[model samples]
Target: MSEPTPTTCMRCAVGCGHLQSGREDGHGVAEAKGNPEHPTNEGADCQRGIEETVDPGGDRLTQPLVRRGGELQPTNWDTAVGVVANRFIEALSNGGGDIAVLGSGQQTTEAVYALGKLARGGFGTRYYDANTRLCMASAVKAYDSAFGSDAPPPTYDDIPKADTHLVWGANPKTAHPVLYRWIAESAAAKDSQLVVVDPVETQTAADADIHIQPAPGTDLA
Candidate 1:
């Protein structure tokens, strides 16, 4: 193994520090371990991180492909980029009103910032949005209506101080294992009441003191 390099895992919004060791030839990652000094996870890593390092599945696309005559063919980087650029130019020349850019929440902050700059400054279009908007738009609207601002008041550190915790429409056990572990530990230590509101009985709901399964669309009601 090569020398371990400290880096941050980008699988989710919650950044976790890790040490990645590459192969001796430095081609790919060989092993990964959580950084003990990191406040977020403190030497605890989820299955996602381990899978990313050791068991990267074989279904990845290494090169760009373009469709020609109803058949996809491998193409070089320049050709692929030219195709995308031409399409963007054509779309902008026709009309910028209907053209919109959608970004993923899983992307790095730098990637998202660059995309925003490209959409707003380069293309001069206000039709750009991220996947986060799909999930948080309702909550943000409610917060804005109630408090005149969209900023949330609570942080992850506030979880331990609460006497009761309620989770809704999220399965943190699979989505955020490290955070779920922390919540479980806190609940066990404090004997706090845990309530889960979900349409289905998830692993998190199984651990909760009370699981309320309301109708799917009636959550807001």
Candidate 2:
């Protein structure tokens, strides 16, 4: 085995830090462990984040492939980027009516900032948007209205310090395992309250001090 490569888990937005100890059996990953020093997860990880069964090249793109001639062919990053730039220029020349810049949740804060700048400053397009808006529009609007930002009210460090955790419509056990670890610990150690609001009895709800199971679509009532 070689030195474990420290990396972040991109399985979810929690972005837990972990170490990837290279595979030994060629069939499965030999070891995947969390970083003890990481402030976000604190040596904790979930099943999906730690235990992954990836068959080599199993529907995963290893390199950039651009359609040349009639099919996608492997190309260098410079060529691929150049091709995309040319396409963007051509589209802009055509009045940019067909141009739209979309960002994803996976992108870092710096990346999204650059993307927004590129869309508004470089491309001069008003059609740019983040994909999260389509799914979490109401939540984003509420956050912006209340806090003047779409980011979460509390940071990852603040979760454990909170006296009462009100988890609404989100199952941290699956979608955010790292967060669940802190919530569960805080509830156990500090005797903090964990209130889960969901229509289903999710794993997160099971660990809650109060599980509010309202009728689906009737939560406000």
Tens-digit lDDT track of model 1 for 1-221: 98878888866666788888898865678898898888888989988977776667778776899999999899999999999898889878966655689998777778989998988877777899986587679979888887788967666788788778888889998899988877887776656988899988899999998999998888876
Compared with the true structure, what per-residue lDDT tens digits does model 2 show for residues 1-221?
55677778756677888877666654345677888878887788877776552223357776789997899999999999999999999989977766899898767677889998988888878888885576579878989998999977788778678889888888987777777888888877666799999998899999899999999898764
Best by lDDT: 1
* Alpha-carbon RMSD, candidate 2: 4.5
Backbone-clash count (model 1): 0
TM-score of each: 0.74, 0.70
For each candidate, C-alpha RMSD in Å?
Answer: 3.7, 4.5
lDDT of each: 0.83, 0.79
Model 1 weakest lDDT span, ten residues long: 90-99
